[model samples]
Target: MSHDNKTAAYFGARDLPDVIDYVGEFGAELVTFLPFVYWLYRAGQLGDRKVSTYRGMRPLYFFLSDDQLIEKDEPRRFVGYQKRTDPSIWGFIPNPNELIATRNAYEAFPNYRKQFQSTRFSFDKPLLVVHNKFNREWNSDTPVNFFSIDQLEQMFSRLKGYYQIVYLRHGRSGSVDGYSPDHNSLIDFDETSVMQRHPEVIDFEQHHREYGGGVAINQYKNELYAACHHFISVQGGGAHQCALFSGSLLLILHKRGPEAVHAYSNGFYQYATNPAPVCMIAFNDRQLQDGLGAFTDASLCQGRVMLGANGSRIANDLAPSRVQRKGQPVFGTDRTPEPGDVGVHF
Candidate 1:
C-alpha cells in the first residue's frame, strides 16, 4: 500500500529489472480488459481511454517487442482490469462468447495499448475552457460489481455498521438507466440509489451533482477519494485508486466465479497485496449448484461511507486551471481508520 515505495523505482531504460513488479511501478496497466463488445461505443461517447491509469503517475515502459505485442495479451493487462501474474493452481473456467468481447476490445480500440509510445493524451492547444453548471445523478454508476446495493446494505446492517457509505463516480447522464448512452456498459448505480430505509447512508454523489457542481466527475471523485472515511475499491472505474493508495478494502462480485472465467481478474483480486476488508464473491448460482463453494456472503461488503462530507469531493492536487475552471474544492481528506476497518485481507 506504499504509494511512494522507492523499492520499485524506475532506474531508467538501461537499468530496468528483468522481472520487476510491473503492476506496482505503473498501476494503470490493470485496465487492459476492456471488452470489444463495447469498444467504439465507449470511444464515441465518453472518450474514455481504454486504460485506467491514475492522473499523475507516468506509465511503465512496455518492453514488449513487435513479436510480443499482440501475442494474445490477457484482458486483465488493461488499466481497468486486475490480472493474475502467476499460474493459477485452480483449473480453467470458461467465459464462452465473452472471449469475443475481449478480442474485439484489443483489435478495434487500441489506444490503451499505445502506452509504449505516449504517456497520456496530449492537447495540441490549451484545452478549451468552458464554464457551466453540469448535473447528472447516477449517470456514471457501474451496474456490475461484487454485490448488489441491496446485498451491501444487508451486509452492513448485520455487521454492526462496518463502514459508512459515500459513493465516488465519473461521467454519468440520462443515458445510464439500464445501459450507458452508447450501450457499451450497463448503468453505473449511485451507492444510495437502492437505499430506501438506511438512515446511516450518506450519498455525496447525489448532493455533489445537485448542489456540489464541478466540471467533471473525476474532479469530484478525487475529492471524494480524499474526503472519505475509507476509499473502498468496490465495483467500478472511478474508485480504482483508493485500493491502490490509501489501502482500503476490495469487494469483487462476479457472475461467473470460475477461477478460469476472467481468470486474470480473479487472480488479481485473489492475490492483491492490500490488507483485508477485501473479499471476492462470485454470485454464480449455476456454479453454486454444482458444488462450487467460491461465493462470499452479501454481509461481507463493508467499504461504503455512512455519512456525506459537508463540502466538495474534488481533490486538492488538481491543476490550477482545473481548480479555477471546474469550480471544485482545492482538496479532500481521509479520516483515521476505525478498529475493524483496518487490515490486509487474507
Candidate 2:
C-alpha cells in the first residue's frame, strides 16, 4: 500500500487539523479519540474546560514520567463528564470494539489491555491509533519536518471563520524565567532572543509581569482557551493542551506566506487516508501578510483543498482497498500505487 493510504484516527477539537493532516499524509486512519482530559493529565498540565463524556466510559492512556507512553493499558475509572450522555459530535469514531467492553467484562477480564492495541490483533489488521497531546512541554519539536504552502492554505481555510485569532508576545529575549520579579516564563524561552530575530510583533512584559507568577499566564491562557474562537501562533504547544481544555482549534503557522510548496514528512498527518477536514493554512511566504494574501483566494477559503499540484492529489489518488477477513478490515487489500501517484515514495 502507498504511504498516503494508511488510516489514522484521533479525537478532540484541539489541533484536530494538525493531528489529522499529520497522520493522513503518512497513511493513517483515525479510529477514535480517547477523552481529552486524559491527555491533559498525561501532559501534566491543567485545562480550562472539560469534554463531554459518552456512554459513561471514556478512553485514556498512561504515559510514564520519563516521557515514554505506556501503550494501551487497562482503562481507568473517572468522575462523569459535565453531562453524562450528550448527542455525539462529528469527529473520529469511538472504538466499536470497546462497545463489547462492558463494565462486568472489563473488570472480569484478568489482563485488561487497552482496546487500542488488542483490536488490531483480533483480525491481523494494521490500524494505527494516536493520542494527541497538546502540552507546552512537548512543543519543542516541530511536528512536521517541513510545511508546504499548499498544506498550510488548506489548513487555514478549514479554520478561517472557525476561530478568533490571538498573537502572544514574549516580553524579553533570554532564557524565559519560569518565575521572576519582573521577569517570567512557563518554560525556558528567551523573549529578547526571539524579538532580536523578529521585532515587528508587540510585547507586553511589564504589563504581564505586574500580574505575577505562572498563575497569571496560566489564567490568561485559560481565559483565552475559554473565550477565544481559536488562537493563532507561529507555534503553540498550549493550543494542543487547550484543545482538550476548551475544545477549540489551534491554528499554527506551518509554512511562510511567500513560500508556495514545501516538504512534509513523518507525523500524525502522514499516517491516515482522510484526516478530519481541519488544517493549517498554506501561505506564499512565512510572513503573516503573505500568508493572509494566499488565504484570501476563494479556492483556498474552503481549507479542505490542498494547493499543491502534487500534494493536493496525494490523498484522493491513494486509496487503499478494503478486504475483509471474517468481515473485518485489513491493510493487505490495498494495491501499491503506480509511479505516477501524487505521494509515491522515491
Candidate 3:
C-alpha cells in the first residue's frame, strides 16, 4: 500500500483528503492531530515515514525528526485546507466517540518539552512571555479573543516588577500560513504608545529584528519559549505554542470559542506540556485581572517556587483545585458565579 493508504489504515479511515479537511483548523491540528502523529511516531509505527505540514509548524514536528522517526525532515506545505465548523471534529478522529476516549491520551506520550529546550535566552529576572494578536473572528466588527491596549497596560503594570517581560504581537506580516484569513488582517492598535509607556517590557519583534540573525522565525520563537517559564497569551496558535513548553504557568485570556470545551472540560492543555504547566483560562477582563492578582500575590508572598503535591515547583498559595471538573468554578464565591469565570487546571 502507498503511504497515504497506510496512514488511512492506521487511522482506520480511507480518505486522506477528507480527514485533512475534517481536521482543518490550525488550533485543532496542534491540539489533536500533531500530538497523535507524534504519538504514532514515538510508538515506532511510522518508521522512516514522512509527514507533510505547513512551513511555520516544522518546529513543532522537530521532536519526531530529532528522534529519527522520519529519515528526512517532513515536507512543509502551504496552507489551503477547508474550514471546519463543527466542534465535534476537533480531535484526532472525526468520530466523536473515539475522540472522547482518546482526546487526552496524548498526555501519556513523551514530553516534547525537553526535546526543544534551550538556555540561550536566560534573563536577569524570571521571564514572562506575553503574546497578543488583533484580528477578526466569527465576522465580528472588532477583534475577539485579543488583549486590548488597556488590558495590556494593566497586565504589564501588575507583573513587570516580578518578571522580565517580553511582549510579542506579530501583526499582518507575521501571520502563519495555516491560520484563518480573518487572522491575517491586522486590527489597528497603538502598540507604539504601549511600548513607550512600558519601557521595561521588551518588544519581542524589535529584539528579533535586531538579533534573529536570519534564523527561521518559528525556530527563533521556539528557542526563546524553551528558555522561559511563564506566559500570558491571547487565545490562538500563540497560546498553544506557549503550552508546549513544560514547567510553566500559562494564563490564556480567551473569551469565547470551541476551544473552551476542550481547554476547560477535556483537560487538553494539561497534555500540551509534559508535567503539564499551570494552565489558567480567563474568560474576560475581570477574570484575567483576578488570575494575575493571584499569581502576583503568590509571587510576593512565597517567592517564585512552591512545592506541589507532585513535588514539582508550582506557584505558591495557588492551591491545586478541581478546576477541570465540568461545571466547577476556579474561584468559589457566595453568590452565583457569573459566566466566563476563571478556570485554572494543573
- Scored by lDDT, the top model is 3
Kindly report which residue pairs in candidate 3 clash with one another: none
Comparison by lDDT, 2 against 3, better one: 3
108-129: candidate 3 lDDT, tens digit per residue: 3335556656666777887788
Question: Can you rank all candidates by lDDT, best first?
Answer: 3, 1, 2
The lDDT per prediction is 0.27, 0.26, 0.57
Best of the candidates, TM-score: 3
TM-score of 2: 0.29
Q: Between candidates 2 and 3, which one is better according to TM-score?
A: 3
Clashes per candidate (backbone, < 3 Å): 38, 60, 0
Give the per-residue lDDT digits (tens) of candidate 2, residues 23-45. 11000111123322333444443
lDDT of 1 by residue, 266-311 (tens): 3332222233213322233232121111111122224322212211
* Candidate 1: Cα lDDT at 194: 48
Q: Tell me how far the alpha carbon of residue 339 in candidate 3 is from the true structure, in angstroms, after superposition.
A: 8.1
Give the poorly placed runs of model 3, Cα more than 4 Å off. 1-23, 64-110, 172-184, 298-346
